[model samples]
Target chain A: AQSVSQHNHHVILSEAASLELGCNYSYGGTVNLFWYVQYPGQHLQLLLKYFSGDPLVKGIKGFEAEFIKSKFSFNLRKPSVQWSDTAEYFCALSGGGNKLTFGTGTQLKVEL
Target chain B: EAGVAQSPRYKIIEKRQSVAFWCNPISGHATLYWYQQILGQGPKLLIQFQNNGVVDDSQLPKDRFSAERLKGVDSTLKIQPAKLEDSAVYLCASSLVAGGHNEQFFGPGTRLTVL
Candidate 1:
């Protein structure tokens, strides 16, 4: 059985502040990693994904994440944040087929 | 392209009652999935279907939870004699293919509240 973990349950940041959300999964074989964002009252949207490319990937809305295989981490990061960035972030992993395993999620609150 | 669609934005049911959630995936998608999302936790995969065939359902509690995707277009998730544990958002997702390259498109989800 595979599982995903997100250490940060809640994160608070101010405008223009840096942001990072920790994500780690317990899987040994080949895996596809993804980060999804959910705005208040909205569905989950893909922020970024890492299938088989550079460890560093950039996504919509000025979001990026680095995949550190050694640590089993795919941390989401943003240099400067805005109030619009306030949303719940989820880390997911997929293998075999379309089935994905997601983390507990981290709720982000960005102050203006 | 249209994203996944789920009906019954909210559902309230008493214990031991039965409920069903509907989902319409993106057109031509080859794979579909249903997930249960508790209030705080992440979405948990309950069932997987590949072109109208069951691919993986190891996590689905067959004792009460059941799902089907007939003709491989839209799908439905049902829970008979529902329990409190089943009170959560039922999220339906779909992908262009079954492989790892494809990303899933999600629906608004149906919020089920079991008393």
Candidate 2:
């Protein structure tokens, strides 16, 4: 079965600090990767997605992810994060259909 | 446009009790999905529906869980004889298409607590 893995279970950082959350998928075939974020009391929203073409995909709120096929990794990164970035991050992958396999999730707390 | 809507945001019930959750997908969305999210974990897909037909229910525990989308617009997930391990947030999502390339819009989710 296809699965996603997020190494960071919890992360705490001061505001304006750089952020990088590791994600890896187990599938070897054609895959579509996605990063979703959920703020406290808010619904889960798409952070970014990689379907094809570009390896580096930019998403809302200055978030970007690089899809490295060789490593089976699509890591989410931000040069500088804000206090508002404190939320739970989830990495998901889809082999073909609408079904999405999600990782255990990473909880990030950005302090002011 | 309104996002996916789920009713009974929080539900608390005893083990062996039955509970149901309702979800209304976005207008014109051809695909609807239900997922389970336990605390400290990411959401897991339970079932997927395309219009009034079922697309996938591989992960669903059919013996204790069942879902229906008769009108192809709204859906309901019912858990009979729930167990303590069934406690989780039920999320409903919708997309314009059934493929993975399309973006999926999610609801606020229904949190279920089985005592």
Candidate 3:
């Protein structure tokens, strides 16, 4: 069965530290990738998405992801993290049929 | 425009009991979806509907779960004789259409605790 994977279960970093969350999917054909985030008490929202064009996609709140087709990965990255960036991040993929397969989320804690 | 809306932000029920969740999608959205998110895990799609018609329900546990979208607008998800493993947040999301590129707008999920 097709699946999405997030290897980093929990990550802790100091404020201003760089952030990288790994995401990989197991689909072979064409894919649409997305990164979603959930703050403390907020609903899950899309941070970024990649469909066809550029492999590097920039999203809201200074977030970006690189979709590497050869590696089947769409890893999310941020240059400088803030305490407010603490949240759970999820990676999702749509191979086709409008169905999304999501990865087990990674919880990031940014300490001041 | 308002986002997807769901009722009963939190619910607590005993195992073997029945519960239901209601979702009102953004006006004019043609696609609605239900997902179950367990602790420490990503949301899993349970069902999808397109304008009052079932588009996909492959992951929904048919024996215990049932969902409906009536009049191509509001939707409801129900679980009968819920099990302890059913404890999770039920999320409702909507999009303009059932397409791979459309962005899905999610609601504040209903946290269901089956004690």
- Stretches of candidate 3 above 4 Å error? none
* Regions of candidate 1 where Cα sits further than 4 Å from its true position: none
DockQ of each: 0.84, 0.90, 0.84
Positional deviation of B58 in candidate 3, in angstroms? Answer: 0.6
- Which candidate comes out best when scored by lDDT? 2
Write candidate 2's Cα lDDT for A41-112 as tens digits: 999999999999999999999999999999999999999999999999999999978889999999999999
Q: Pick the candidate with the highest DockQ.
A: 2
Fraction of native contacts, model 2: 0.88
Residues A6-62, candidate 1: write the lDDT tens digits: 999999999999999999998878889999999999999899999987999999999
- Candidate with top TM-score is 2
Candidate 1 lDDT by residue in tens digits, B1-115: 7889999999999999999999999999989999999999999999989989999999999999899998999999999999988889999999888887688999999999999
Estimate the TM-score of every prediction: 0.98, 0.99, 0.98
Tell me the tens digit of each residue's lDDT in model 3 across B7-33.
Answer: 899999999999999999999999999
Per-residue lDDT of candidate 3, residues A1-112 (tens digit): 5789999999999999999999989986889899999999999999999999999999999999999988989999999999999999999998887788899999999999
**Residue pairs with backbone atoms closer than 3 Å in model 3 (clashes):** none
